[model samples]
Target chain A: MNQYTAQQWRRYTIRVGIYVALLLMTAIFLIPVYVVIVTAFKNPAEINLASTWQLPTELYWQSFSEVMAEFGPRFGNSVQLVIGATILSSIMGSMNGYVLSKWEIPGHKFLFPLMLFGMFIPYQAILIPLFEFMRDIDLYGGIPGLILIHVVYGLPITTLIFRNFYVDIPDEMLEAAAIDGAGFWKLYTDIVFPLSIPGFVVVIIWQFTQIWNEFLFAVTMTSNDAQPITVGLAQLAGGEAVKWNLPMAGAIVAALPPLIVYIVLGRYFIRGLLAGSIKG
Target chain B: MKNNRDRSIAFLMLLPSLILLGIFVYFFIGRAIQSSMTDWGENPAQPPLSETVEISYVGLDNYVRLMTSFTESSFRVSLVNTFFFTIFFVAGCIMVGLFLAILLDQRVAGEGIFRTIFLFPMALSFVVTGTIWRWMLQPRGGVNILPTLIGLDPIDFAWVNSQETWFQFLWQDVPRILTFVGIGILLIMAVRYALNQRWRSMGFVAAAAIVGLLVFMAGAWDYIWPALDVPAAEPTIAPKGFNVALLGVIIAAVWQMSGYTMAMFIAGIRGVAEELREAARVDGASELGVYRYIILPQLNPIILSAMIILGHISLKIFDLVFAMAGPDNAKTIVPGILVYTKGFRANAFASASAVAVIMLFFVAIIIIPYLWTQLRSDDD
Candidate 1:
């Protein structure tokens, strides 16, 4: 699309030049992806010395398969945490958002701040309290305990996003639903929830990546079979039973769910982040 | 429409998070307040499951121990080392990060390649970064080899010396701190540089190089290449409290995070209004002057936000220390690790909970101001 008169174009090639620069600029963002991918594919000898830029000529299956078999349970642990947290967070986040946005409840502003406090509080500050709470209830080192930890950390932003989005809907819609004798469940699942899918997706992606990659709670809440992959990945020391090739393969395999999400929803990730940050 | 249901619905909606946050975050903090009042680490003879637990109510005992005994131990020395570690680490990252971001922002030749080169740090998990950096920063690694290639003697940095102490003094047994503060300064500078794009375009490479030479010559690199990244101590049972090397751990953590902060700053800069820059120019201000007067003031919010986020990140750093300290090195102590140590290794569940609760309190104090601004700043 260099459609321009030569005389006119010569006078201002700056815009044309800038676009070319941008094409190259875009590649910078993509380089890490390339590096990680290439690292995952290369055989051991070729790993450090091979042109890190070039694609593999032959797909290395052993590393990939070995990592999978070794790390499959670890991933399962992580997935278990992610799945449990996602359902709880989305529902709780949605309900809180809808109620806050639609209702004129007492002390909403003050309560909002109290809720908002959760987002800014660092994970370190809560670990002890969470540890004690989990241990007290005898839920420590299990899926249920981990789910509570995940949801506790997750609520603030998810709640904030859904609240921000719900503000867009008409008060009349909520009022009319109530007038029509719709109860909370009927009103929510039917009226409010459907309208918030895009907002829901945004929260889902944020929560999903967070729980998927989260190491702190994963390491703390569980130690054995219940240990999440993030913990499992960190424990790779290449002992007698441990093969680094498998770990590398496992790391690659472990990285896929989010990596795939990044590839597919790359645009959405940026967009959703922009929406959150710009408003945030 | 009638709505007594509003309050109930609101409470119900808020129920799940409140219960969790209250139990885990708030109520558990109350528990920490209670636990910290007692001595959980003592009375080891009392079985873990004993109902009439013999833990004495040693009021402010841990705080006293934290200030005196714990701080006197290698772990506390490690904590102080973290303080020292953070200063330099934050500086190095900001310097290089701001430099790279601006260089990339200028739209230079092979900019994509360089930008990615800069960002390669972010994709890696801290565990991986720690591993790679260990290879690079180790005295025996390729880094010192570069110096030797240029006719310099091979520097035997303490980083590879398994028994080397980080600090040495002849004074009355003041605890010796072991931290990688020297490299920490460099890393912090790099991060600052990454966050500030204009600094990057200015590419005071000659200045940076001089600084690097000066720093390396000034014994900054000495502490960074510690004597014991691996274990020389016989692998034995994981000990109770205070074995961690906190200083070295915090430094490695700061190195890993500073680059990420740069990306955030870039995002912040993009958020600034371009029209204001044009207006400043129209007012006959020089580019740098315009930036000094207009750009920096606009960037205050982002800078504050970055500091807050970084502070929080710093407090919870476990990955870098864990990787660097190895199994037998008693230097990777933080509340997070302490909790893991207590619950999983020692099976002292109540004590671990207390540590988690205490750490959470510390986190809240740092986070509150930032949260206040975050919630209200949008309206402004």
Candidate 2:
């Protein structure tokens, strides 16, 4: 009885230790979020070095109003860009994945790896040529062009995630549809497409977050009129005589859409994240 | 007849993507390679953006200059900075991730909440992360002032603007250092192969190691790649090393990405069969021993995958550094920023493409092997 009590006590101590460690880590991870929130809420007059960590005296609505005014157009641009790009890329990825995984496409063994390689190359390697090509085609500076860039570049990973997702779907299901005189299009629509809602969710979340948060293409591919929220936030934070509150507000505003998606559908988000890297 | 038609339909469906990817990924890469070997922006006669400009082929002149030119010290520094950043960022993510995974694996309360807090940052843009961290790491405010709340002097460390460097090395010695590092890796590989009793592979690795050692001893690096030699006029010995300013950027990067690794590890830890762990515990293993001996070994592949993913991300890191330390801050410059500033700002297209090509080479070095192994495993 004494030995058992000692073991229980030790286990209790270990559990307590784990919680403490976890809480400490949690605090560290959330520090920036805390700072960003507090800074965003603090009035410009109250924002300074000495009172950095202090809670705001009162809620300040001015920063958000000002940031919204400045970033309103860019925010719309990001939405349009993300939505257009996400839908196009996800549809294409699903079809490609369906064909590659379910159909008997020749050279798929070689093609899959070739496509996978595209996602990993530093986009910098192709940036110059892409810039020139965009210019030559008169698609250099608009939301549509940016959408195209995102969709094309996004194909590899979206296709990858969907392919991995589709491989799990039994081939017998497809064979049955084929035997029912369902041609390729009918089979996909009847059997595969309906079953891919979960895959679509994963791909959509991944692409939305990626295209929304993307800075390089947004900054480079778009002109001033088509700049995304990322560019606006960058300029807001990057100015010489910036009020911290405004940029902090901008950061929060820019981060919210994806944050909401992540918080709500986090399981699918993680599935997308893991699928992009780890093989199924 | 139906199968042939179906195959044709499949081919037709794949055609557009194949064409797009071919142009955007492969064909454009070829174009960038060609652009990098030109004098488009270097020569006075060929303005980079001119409608009717001449672009003469320079045959690796841009690469040679980037590697050795006195004016291009920034490129070399950026290269070294990326190397250090990748090492620390990858290692930090794995350690933090593994720890968090272990802690959460203990059936902790509110695991979902803790996980959400940890991972929410991953959803934010690097630009957002950079902006927030830039504020938090302000020299006079933010994190620096946190100590004051606890009754200490406000810490005054310059997070993003520090000019201090660590582990300094002369530019002239880079070749020797690379050679030595290569030899070290080969030696390690040889040992691992020996342990596995793979004599033929071990013999090949040993041969490579011996050749690397001979090259190092003979000091043939400069003679073989003469561009690495410092130019005579700038003989003051350009020094390159890890800049302290990048510490803040690396910290922010790790903060954002460690969650990803944690997720990977948690999945890996959960995948470990309960029976294996129970058996280990029954054999008198401590909880720590079960993790250190059993769980961690099974997580090796997750760790490798995480490392490769994070490594490539770090290698091409641009936006975070750009947002935290603006494009012109030489102290925190990276190749991605250099490409941006050079091509976009300075119109130095040739040099920009050269830097970009170098970045691609480094990424390819890490990614190709990973993809090969990963895809091959899928085939099996």
How far residue B6's Cα lies from its native spot in candidate 1, in Å, is 4.0
lDDT of 2 by residue, B266-294 (tens): 99999999999999999999989999999
Error of 1 at A223 (Å): 4.4
- DockQ, candidate 1, vs. native dimer: 0.30
Give the lowest summed-lDDT range of ten residues in model 1 chain B: B170-179
Instruction: State which candidate has the highest DockQ.
Output: 2
DockQ of each: 0.30, 0.78
Q: List clashing residue pairs in candidate 2.
A: none
Off by over 4 Å in 1: A1-60, A120-138, A168-191, A238-246, A267-279, B70-72, B92-260, B347-358, B377-380
Kindly state the number of residue pairs that clash in model 1. Answer: 54
Winner by lDDT: 2
CA error at residue A186 for candidate 2, angstroms? 1.0
Model 1, range A47-133, lDDT digits (tens) per residue?
532143456667777777666665678778888889999888888888888877777667677677687667655465456556656
